[model samples]
Target: MDLFDRLQEQIGTVRLPLFAVTVTAAAQVNTPLIAILHWHGFRRATPLVLPGVEIPSRAVPGSAIQLDAPWHSFETVDAMLLDAAWQSGAWDVERVEQRGCNVIGASAAETLACRQAFGDYGEDMVRDPQLLGDETDRDGLMQLAARRGYVRWLFRPVKGGLWRTLDEPDDTLEVDGGRQPPCPVSPVPRRPGGSGRTVYRLGKVHRILLPR
Candidate 1:
């Protein structure tokens, strides 16, 4: 099966009556993902953590983040374009919109965003109805989130992974046979006259042979 199908099976069946999936690179070529959750009627978001999951890093080409959103939030989301925050790498971000019971949404986010967004929703700081209450402008809040570090809201939706990543392109740019993990540093060619211990980059860590 292709990568998407496996993810569907691994992700299992969710309770959302309707949801949308978009394809975005998780990181440069084969790095892990930086998924985020956007709940309806809330201005902020939390990490989209898929617990106890182990699949090939390549199997997850794009986002695995799930969002439980209301109609407004769902409609605002586009498959081609998605919401994401910069962490260290610039890659496409996949967003899923789930509308159903038993799925995590705004109520949960109010607590989750306590340290991330502001303080608690109502205790330490007052909840902004315009940002969180009915018809919540999630995009607006995320756009405003750009100002804060540690966590950034995707207005145009950008990338990063723990720390800033190299300016290399993700796996999508390469052909199937050429796909490989991102090298932290670029490989320098051997000098014309110099020889001992030439610096090199490994495209496939598992391979025993060196490329000619």
Candidate 2:
């Protein structure tokens, strides 16, 4: 089983807001190291600090995602409670923090490397500026990222009151009008009696399209 499978075992099918997910990542600095991806329109920026390949998010002062690694996994992430179930996405922060929120024992690092080295659109996608900087465009950053590694972290804030987490990305795999794309997501098998719990493994994607 890969990190995705192990993650589901650790934290059941609990769906959470994007904020909560980042906070949990902050708390878990060592084990199950995670690299966050903070999307900024067509511009890619570092997310809040954690560790590993650090970068700071331009959106929030701190935000980051690093799926481009091998050691990265979701294990340390435990759990927190909402003082009150979300109602229209409005609530008191003081009350919520007071009621729950595991301490961020450590913090993530601020990073711009992911954005700096690679172009905003990641057309370059080169990690090592010295060795492959010039050849990045032709060598392919996606392959370099693969050499470094990558894991697709997918989640829907509230799907049936449970956060829907998946191993792979599904947007491109679907077809609103035409037929499905060439590369379809490889799904992670579900355990016995598992309902509404499915994970799709990422397939090969050649381009690093601008993130919105």
Candidate 3:
């Protein structure tokens, strides 16, 4: 099946914890994210980590580390980080959203100012009503959200080992045939014929893979 479907089969209804990773190439700035809880409110102010490439002490003001190789060495670093996260089982796919500009963990006030400066540049997917009893769930999702640029809530629903993209563009992108995973049929909701209620199959949870 496609990558999304395979993810679904792995993580059932258990909502996984969110982990955010922001990278800055030399002079470039960092992008942050926010999280949304399945049954609670938003989360922010989680311990976000920054493990950048080790560059020579003397180099361009803002250039990321570079090494001469047949292919791009940076790609190797990225793969290593992704693999590490997958093994940790603490984080899922990395969410991508457009922040006003890349700003690393400068300060809470400064970050808030930057977010306010942007003023709704990206989509906000937090639609569930703000509940008060789910402190644990809210905390986890919020930390995940803070790490991303925009809050793209990653979810893997139950039934049908299918990986579905939520509010993100997946089907529109192009990819190499050899590298692309098999796409599976998305789960369908069962029809309710005078029944009190029917269960809709949500997708599964698997590792998130960002495009190169």
Tell me the tens digit of each residue's lDDT in model 2 across 1-212: 13222222323422222322221122112323232222221222533556686453223221232222232223212111111112111111111001011124312211222222222224333441211112223124323432332222233222121222332332322221112222232224323321122332222345666665
Alpha-carbon RMSD to native, per candidate: 20.8, 19.7, 20.1
The Cα error of candidate 3 at residue 143, in Å, is 22
Q: Pick the candidate with the highest lDDT.
A: 3
Output the lDDT of residue 171, model 2.
Answer: 34
Query: What lDDT, from 0 to 1, does candidate 1 have?
Result: 0.26
Candidate 2 error regions (>4 Å):
1-34, 37-62, 65-120, 123-144, 159-212
lDDT of 3 by residue, 93-211 (tens): 33222332234744665345334222211223143223223222323322333443332223322112122222333332233101122222222222222112222122233557678
Q: What TM-score would you give candidate 3 relative to the actual structure?
A: 0.19
The true-structure Cα RMSD of candidate 1 reads 20.8
lDDT of 1 by residue, 38-131 (tens): 2211112334556895432211112234233222221122211221111112243322221111224435552343223321234423423212
TM-score, candidate number 2: 0.20
Per-candidate TM-scores read 0.20, 0.20, 0.19
Q: Tell me how many clashing residue pairs each candidate has.
A: 8, 24, 27
- The runs of at least 3 residues in candidate 3 whose Cα sits more than 4 Å from the true structure, single-residue gaps closed, are 1-74, 95-212
